[model samples]
Target: MSGPGRFISFEGIDGSGKSTQARRLAAHLEGLGHSVVLTREPGGSPGAEDIRALVLEGEPDRWSPETELLLFTAARRDHLERTIRPALEAGQIVICDRFADSTRMYQGLRRAGLRVLVDQLHDLMIGQEPDLTVLIDMDPETGLARALSRNGGEERFESFGNDLQAKMRAGFLDLAAEFPDRFVTIDGARAMDDVTADVTARVTEWLA
Candidate 1:
């Protein structure tokens, strides 16, 4: 139950249950007496939250992919500076619902050459990656259904529909393979408790 400061992130298509799992893991870690900081990207800090409204709201085409990349990068910078870095320095387990990987998949996969821009911006401004990333792998059909059921106002990305979600899922899996040292792909289609247990087990092994 005791370990060094750790930074963890959860990632997946919107309805893949990453956010719920992230919160569950944070609570589980806290139950073990570890200090935990639970947060999310695009809105972890004040500045980032402001930007989040702009980027996540409005029409799907409100911002061009290029402009969206810049906005996300800016929001990430603020979140890192104001929230993540300080918690990590203070020796707390930081559990982020989403991180740069989302930006990479969401923005990068949108168009040709954008992935390169996403990587470049991340390297230049936000030169940090989570110590561990839990990717909740789910079918696009199931995931999209879950996302739409929420009836949330932030449907900008979800509005892209099933085909894009399928591609995004593939992109996340590729990233997990590309960064095996830090990424763990979890089967998200299972029951919530089952998926949570799997995620908990993975983090426990890593911490051990």
Candidate 2:
């Protein structure tokens, strides 16, 4: 990891298949002769990994939104210092799964009555924005259904009202609209291979 380069992030809810897409895209980039660093938020670093376990375990509802935001930020700062920044400095492409936008959706807006707290904490933390953020927008019901099929139990967020999840999905779309250049919205309902193909194509154009 040597010269300065680009940083990319993938954002979505539990069932959106962001991790799969991220990994596929990384491999695609590597095949094209680019050095790539694949990582994730809240646990890419050693300290972040510890926090990640706590943050994701039990239930997202177990912790308050403000507290959740703090935990995520703590992990993010460490992730940037330990993993992301180093790869970027070395001219490698860094692709992260579920970055700050997840916080904005889950902790900030999705959690009832935490919008203000989410905003304040968002500003305080998450200094570095991704050069490209791929938001895999999809229906909450379908997404949750997929998640449940893959994993047995429903977490705190999954048990939330449909309205909240819908709003979160919309929030992702709005974020993309607000940052047209930096955001790419893909059809997350599609098959994994299709989604990965679209992502790789988008990144290819961006690289050129």
Candidate 3:
């Protein structure tokens, strides 16, 4: 919140390649002699990692939308206390794979009118946003195929299938429009290198 270090987060549909891009950005910043902390939501710290397993590895309907929101909020609180805030306070760039924006899309859109609840809980528990939010926008069907092919154990959300992914893509774009100052939308349909180059250029300019 009141730190010299910058916070950056990447958000997208499940297979938009944000995670890979996050890792690359961290490494790039580190190569430039910056101290960096690369982490992810639902699991940035020890306690949060435990919570990640619960929410990410279950069936699509394992938890009600409200229940899932609570779990995610708890994980984010721990992540903030144990990982994110500490790094920022120490003047280290923190690159997070996903943040509150993910929750807004995933759970908030799970049911009609749940977004209000999501925003309320976020304001109450986790009152933070990234300095920069990189949104990798991609086509839902293609993203779904990429997500399913990974065969990651954490496929609870992906198991919901393509329809959800379509909604998520639209929702992410809407968020970018809503929060224009911090959000940068990138076309993820390009080759990975092209996407990476564009992202790196944009972030480097921002840092400068």
lDDT of 3 by residue, 1-208 (tens): 7388899999999999999999999988889999999999989999999999999997888999999999999999999999999999999999999999999999989899999999999999999999999999999999999999999799999999898999999999999999999999999999999999999999999999
Ranking of candidates on TM-score, top first: 3, 1, 2
Instruction: Estimate the TM-score for candidate 1.
Output: 0.97
Task: Write candidate 1's Cα lDDT for 1-208 as tens digits.
Answer: 1135689999999799999999999999999899999999888999999999999889888999999999999999999988898888888999998999999999999998889989999999999999999999999999999998998898889999998999999999999999999999999989999999999999988988
Candidate 2: residue 7 lDDT (0-100): 90
Computed on alpha carbons, the lDDT of every model, listed in order, comes to 0.92, 0.82, 0.94
Clashes of each: 0, 2, 0
Better model by lDDT: candidate 1 vs candidate 2:
1
Which 10-residue window of candidate 3 scores lowest in summed lDDT? Answer: 1-10
Cα TM-score per model: 0.97, 0.90, 0.98
On TM-score, the candidate that comes out on top is: 3
Candidates in descending lDDT order: 3, 1, 2
Off by over 4 Å in 1: 1-4
Task: Indicate the TM-score of model 3.
Answer: 0.98
Model 3: which residue pairs collide? none
Candidate 2 lDDT, tens digit per residue, 1-208?
A: 2248889999987678888899999999999999999998768989999987787768546887778888888898899888988888988899999787888888778457776676676667656888899988888888777766766443556766567778788888888988899999999998888898899999899988
